[model samples]
Target: MPEYGPQPVERQLPTEEARDLLDLVREMARREVRPTVDADEEAGRFPRDTFRQLSASGLLGLPYPSEYGGGDQPYEVYLQVLEELAHASLTVGLGTSVHTLSCHALAEFGSKEQRSARLPDMLGGGTLGAYCLSEPTSGSDAASLRTKARRDGDEWVIEGTKAWITHGGIADFYTVLARTGEAGPRGITAFLVPGDAPGLTFAAPERKMGMRGSPTAQVHFDGVRLPEHNRVGEEGQGFAIALSALASGRLGIAACAVGLAQAALDEALRYLHQRRQFGRPLADFQGLHFMVADMATQIEAGRSLLLTAARLRDSGRPFARQAAMAKLHCTDAAMRVTTDAVQLLGGYGYTTDFPLERHMREAKVLQIVEGTNQIQRLVIARDLLGPEEG
Candidate 1:
């Protein structure tokens, strides 16, 4: 937004390779993502081609192991990559995150044979994925999900629906969480269902407020059959696997939030500088200057929290609390910053003439997805004051 190139995001990358990776990502964002994001999003066009390009460029599998087509990059580096992508186009950024989340069950808990057979295609074959955990009856209370999976001979017959599925109708694969045993979280089990599996159907994508470039829909499994080998983990381990995946998933949302906020801040600053008022630059107004400072400060703070949690995760430590906190703080900050950006632009912000309005809408969803801000606060509170007891 400033005349002097882009505002540099200060990062403590672990290696030269990581720095090079960021440079490459910036180039991709500038060339492939940013230029057409607004138009494509407006048209509700899924940027499948852009995702393919990212897969080809090795951007889709950054944090996973290279043995299975991943880049073997650290979580810190991977989160920064997400931030860069979100700064350009949130659809691409959040899509990449969902892809990563969908791969976790197979890559982390699947048998050696399963990973050997499935992880490669998922990580690098340009096949989009969706994680199916939320259902019509379940959102934050995923344990209460009613999706059912019954063992019928050599196959598991899955039935019920998954709501708020990213890439739902169009995903090549879905990591579905269904009830296989008792009730509650332990009864849940994860299944890898092929998109073309018989009895699998998708509702039309939701007409959402923002990030429309990514499809979100209701996925219905009507006795869809999959071989027993498709089960990702133990019969009663689905909820655990889901939680583990979410701990990491929350970090992705946090990074995307920071990126969105940064983009909003960038737009606001540029518009202020160019849109003059009362014979002076809008940016020169002391009140607006304070607002910009606050926005920038919030962005940096959120980034720091996310990276710290990422580093903890990369180092094999428990970073769930940090991830929750970061998700809570960053998404809230994005909502505030983007709304402020709209305010700074005055009436122009409300119009389609500027991207600020779209960004403001996009920022609202971040506060709800991955884990709602209320859920995040619950998590942080649980960390501070143990889980509630009966």
Candidate 2:
């Protein structure tokens, strides 16, 4: 095994108060989330009660302003809490992260009246949200979306379909992006559509290989009517808002990926110490020890990158490139770490008896969602080389 050096120092450490918050979050994860995760995943159960508990604990609105019943925690602290939740269950972790991203439109760009009317229910309790951006024809190329929103007097009638919405049918609200102008990305606009809107409907949840507990569906808006006040930001600004929201959402996914990797590493380490082979502990073998070392090193590096991007966000610095880099690196690291975890577990890792298989499955989706790793690379390259070349 390679001789490991001291772990790199964290540029910013959690304060005592932040540590206490993390403890509370970890306690919730261990007590309420961890035990139920496998069963829930197997049964395809959505943990509405878990989210309600999170809301009550003031976790649902972490990083938002306290005036709106949020914890007003920094993004760095908020991401750590998300990491803890994800270490327990990727379903809940990803769902919460998506919900937070859905709220960004209203919180950052909605009119005062819109915020007053909508944010309390979303940020407080009893309401979950979904962000609607991707369409069947356009996943990576959001500029090519075909969903239409037409203005008529005081109402905008939305007619389109959104694919892969995380909380499609179950959410209380949706932040929908629709085409409202000429063509391409500039035509897009966002609207806050109630789940119970008359013309809104959903397909059955997708049957996926992982994160089965969290619902994913196709949301159809067949002339869904919304008042003009529901529009979030200026019409052309929707794409910008969506991009901004996604930049942050990518960080959330990165944090969740790291958490998943950590969970896998912990499980493998525990099993390695206990599972004897060839008259010795599995951890004693040189080859396995080297693998374990690599997993730990990758996790620490992912954590460093995630926190760096989060701190940049909290400081109100330009961090789109950093966020993309973190998301790409962390999720890629997760895929590698989780795969090795299964390898370490031997036959048990391939079976549903252990959580490593599920972690591996969940890690795959993190690489694809909130902007694919390819897209992240593009974002980074654009940042470094300037958009004229892009």
Candidate 3:
């Protein structure tokens, strides 16, 4: 398949800096990332080197504080950049999102001492991160995570497993949520665990259908020990911290889904223009043309919603509900647009000779990742009404 970016997005960036950032991102995506997709994804090879290059180029920490190696861009610009990257390769874009999510607790809630000591490396010192909140028994019920961390003098001994961790084995550090006091949300605490901790281990990466270039594995804490200083925020605050981080992470997923959908739409349009059907170009068919138009329209709509959510976040306003809605809408649009692209391309879309099938497969995971679409609706409904009743 010919791998190239979709048509450029007409972004409403706040500054010339943001526009330049997007330009650089598009260039990199076209030259560096697009060429590697087929081989790396097919071989299930994690693009560690590509990530290292992104880090060196300062693309990995756009939304954090510049004092600590970040680009210090607003969430609005950061998310747009994410869309560009994801349009090139979902593995790269989604991996960057997960990495940024892993940094949130410390960046937003850590002590000054912790920020001074850790944020620089976590943000841009070529370090990768993973967030550990969901256990095998608890996915959406993240507060019920079974991981336990017990105080032992100046250290904490942690045990239990975290499932579906992106960058699990290869990450440089992990932001972990564990039961520190009681049986529920209020008892959890967050900690920063080094990847090379004495007892930290990982199961084999999951055999996934798409985005296989990004490793998703089960991370086990087998009596892993962390310093007392590694704790993030106050005790009993991990659940809130996790939720806050996810609010932003949801937007990242939304942008990526929009990009994935756009890529599929772009390719489908190209094929329609070039390929003939019934002795006429597929683009000449009103039916296929309508499908293309709808796909493009939905992708644009999703992009607007996602950017609105990002702007709300940048304004320091309460945006959880908008974020959830964006995630739900964009991911669903991606699934629909990609499926439609497959239909638009007919037989070729079903084969590896084209990227529509891969986009379709990858789009499905966006609905499940960050938060499942079902959970997203619950979140939106709760915002519209009130908390779910027992």
Among the numbered candidates, top lDDT falls to 1
User: In TM-score terms, which candidate is top?
Assistant: 1
| Every model's TM-score | 0.98, 0.96, 0.97
- Please provide, for model 2 over 1-390, each residue's C-alpha lDDT reduced to its tens digit, 9 standing for 90 to 100: 753322222434468888778878888998999999999999999999999999888888897877666778889998888888998999989988999999999889988787777787888776899999999999999988999999898999999899999988999999999999988888999899998999999999999999999999999999899998889999888999999999999999999998999999988988888898999988789999899899999998999898999989999999999999999999999999999999999999999999999999999999999999999999999899888642
How would you encode candidate 1's per-residue C-alpha lDDT over 292-368 as one tens digit per residue? 88988899999999999999999899999999999999999999999999999999999999999999999999999
TM-score: model 2 vs. ground truth = 0.96
- Candidate lDDT (C-alpha), each: 0.93, 0.91, 0.92
Question: 1-390, model 3: which lDDT tens digit per residue?
Answer: 753334556888999988888999999999999999988999999888888889988988899999878898999999999998999999999999999999999999999899999998888889999999888999988888889999998899999999999998999999999999988899999999999999999999999989999999999999999888999999999999999999999999999998888889888878887898789878788877688888888999899998899889999999999999999999999999999999988999999999889999999999999989999999999999998689
Q: In model 2, which range of ten residues has the least summed lDDT? A: 3-12
* Rank by TM-score (best first): 1, 3, 2
Q: Please give the RMSD of candidate 1 to the true structure.
A: 1.3
